[model samples]
Target: MSDKPNDLQKIRSVADYQFGKGVGEKLFPGGVKIVHSKRTGRIRHVYLEEKRLATLRPTNGLFSLNIAGAKRIMKHVKPQRLWVRVREEAEPFVARGKSVFAKHVIDADEEIRPQEEVTVTNEKGKVLAVGRAMLSGKEMKAFKRGVAVRVRRGVAEEVKKETLTLV
Candidate 1:
C-alpha cells in the first residue's frame, strides 16, 4: 500500500470524519474545521478561533491553501498588485479653459479619515479598489483632489448611483 491514504469519496459533516484526516491536524490542531465533499475531491474549510482563515478549493492533484487573514495582511501591508475602478461617468469640468474636475469620486465611508487606507467600492458594495484617502468623508464632498482615491485597480463598469432613504 502507498503512503498516500485512499482518495476520500464523500464527507458528510464535522461528526462524520476524523479531525486531522481531511483538514490535517498539523495545520489546525484544535480549531474548528469544516469540509465539504466535492465532485473532484474533498475541499477543506479552516477557521482559527472564530474567523475563517482559508479554503482549499478543488485542484487537479495537490495544492496549498493560504489562510485568509495572512492573505489580507499581505494585501494590506505589502500588496503585490493594485486595482481600481471608475465609479461613474464623469467629464472634466473646466474653469477658464483649464481642466478643473476629476472623472471619479470616492464615496463616503462612515469612519473614513484623511490619509487612512480604504477600499473603494461601487453602489452594489463590490470593492473597486483600495487607496489612501486624501480627504475625510466630509472633505471629499467639497474638495477636488490631490489623490482622493489613487485608483490602484480600475474596474471596467460604470458605477451606478444609489439612492439613500432617511427614516
Candidate 2:
C-alpha cells in the first residue's frame, strides 16, 4: 500500500510541472481529482464542478467588472493585479543619432493604463528599459502609428534604416 502523503506530494509535483508553480494552489486550493488515461499523457484536464466555477464568477457569469462595479459586488474582496511575463525584445530607434521611436513592442501587460510606468524586458526576461505608456492596452493591441513607450533608462539598440525614395 502507498502512503497518502507520498501520493499527494507526487500529485503536487506533477501539477507544478504542468501548470507552473503556484498555479495548482490558485486553481485548486482544496484539492482536485486527477484522472490518468493512456490516450492522454499523465494527467488530462483539471476538473472543477459547476458549483466551484459558479463561486468564482462575479455577476451572472462575468469574470470582468469595472473597479467601481466590482467593489460594490464584492466588498470584502480586494482587487488583485496580475502580471504576465512575455518573451520578446523592444529597442529604441534613432534617426541621425537622435532618439526617435521603438522598433518593436515587447511583451505587454494588457491591463496597463496610459502614462503608467512599465518595465520593458527582452525575450529572456532581462530588463531593457523603463518607460511611460503612451497608449492604453486596447490601443497598443492595434497600434500602427506614434510612439508607444518613451524609454527613459537602460540600453537602447540602434536599428538599420532603409533609404527613402520620393515618388
Candidate 3:
C-alpha cells in the first residue's frame, strides 16, 4: 500500500508479459491508480481518473482488458498483435457483442492461442470488441462454422450507453 511505484511496475511488467514488450509503459502511463483487492491484497483493477483500463485476473494472473485498454493497445502498439479481423458483413453483429464465427474472419494474428485475450476489429483495423479467443488464430482462419472469439464487451454497446448519457 505504501509503494505505488512498485505496484505500477508490477502491473506494467505483467502487461508486457501478457501483451508484448514495451506495452506495459504504453498501456499504463504515469498518474494511473492501481487498485488492490481488499481480501487478497493483490492487484485487481487499474484506472485512469474514472475509466478502468484493465483488470488483473486472479485465476490466470493476466489481464482482462476493457475497451479503453483495447484501444490503447491498438493505438500504441505497432504491428498489432492478438487481433482478429472480421468481415464487413459481420461487423455490426460483432460490434454489438455477438460471438465471432470463424466464417466471418478475414484475418488474425497467427500467434494468438485459445483462451487468450484478443481484440476483434473491422477490416479497417478499428477495434470493435475485446474477447477471449475460443480458437487458435490458425484454426480461426482454417475453419468456417465454429465460434472464434467470445466477445466480452462490444464497442457498440459502450457507444450506445455513452450516447444515452450524453442525450
Candidate 4:
C-alpha cells in the first residue's frame, strides 16, 4: 500500500525533472491510473482512464510522452523542455500530420537531444505534433535538410479528444 504511493511520487518527480514544473500535476491528475506490467509489476503505462498518456521505457525506465500527454503538458508548461518550434508556414503541414523538417524549424529547446521525445509547435506555441527528435537542437537550427522531428502523432480532430475520463 505504501509502496504504491511512493512509486507514484517518484513518477511525478521524474515528470517534473524531465519536463518542467506543473507538468506532472497536469499530466497525472488525481485518479490517474498507472498500469503495471503483468510479469515485472513495473509501471508500463500511465493513463487517464482510456486515454494513454505515456509509456515507461523498459530499457531506460524513462517516460516517453504520447500525444495526449504532450497536449496536456503543452497547455501548462512553456516551450523550454523537449520542444521544437516551427515556423507558421510549417504549421499547416505539421498539423496535417507531417514530420517536421529542419528547414522549417524556427527555434527549439536547446536542451533537446537526438532520439528524445519532443513536441512540435507553431510560432504561437500551438502544439502540432508529438514526436521523437531526429537531430539535436543545434543541428536542427544549423542544418537545412533532414528531418527534425519524426512525428508519432499529429493534431487532427481525431487526436484532440475532450477531457480525460478518470479511471
lDDT leader: 3
Per-residue lDDT of 7-99 in model 4, one digit per residue for the tens? 668678778877777677777888788899999998899888778888888998778887778888877666458889999888878876789
The lDDT values for all models are 0.38, 0.38, 0.94, 0.82
Residue by residue across 1-167, what tens digits does model 3's lDDT show?
A: 56556888999999999999999999999989989999999999999876789999999899999898999999999988999999999999988999999999999999999999999999999999999999999999999899999999999988898889899
Highest TM-score among the candidates is held by which one? 3
Worst 10 residues of 2 by lDDT: 50-59
Give candidate 4's TM-score.
Answer: 0.80
All candidates in order of TM-score, best leading: 3, 4, 2, 1
lDDT of 3 at 164: 100
Candidate 3: which pairs clash? none
Tens-place lDDT per residue, model 1, 1-167, is 76754323222122122221333333344544555556544666556565454454354322222323323433433221111223444311110112112235534643456554444544444444444456665555556654555432222211211112221
- Model 1 TM-score (2 dp): 0.33
RMSD of 1: 15.4
Question: What TM-score do all the candidates reach, one by one?
Answer: 0.33, 0.35, 0.92, 0.80
| Stretch of 10 with least lDDT, candidate 4 | 158-167
Off by over 4 Å in 2: 1-103, 156-167
Q: Write the per-residue lDDT of candidate 2 for residues 1-167, one digit (tens) a residue.
A: 84555433554454344324543345443554544445634443333442111111212221211122212222222232221122242332211222213335543667767665444545554445444567765555466566666554433321111122221
Residue 68's C-alpha lDDT in candidate 2?
21
Q: Report the alpha-carbon TM-score of model 3 versus the true structure.
A: 0.92
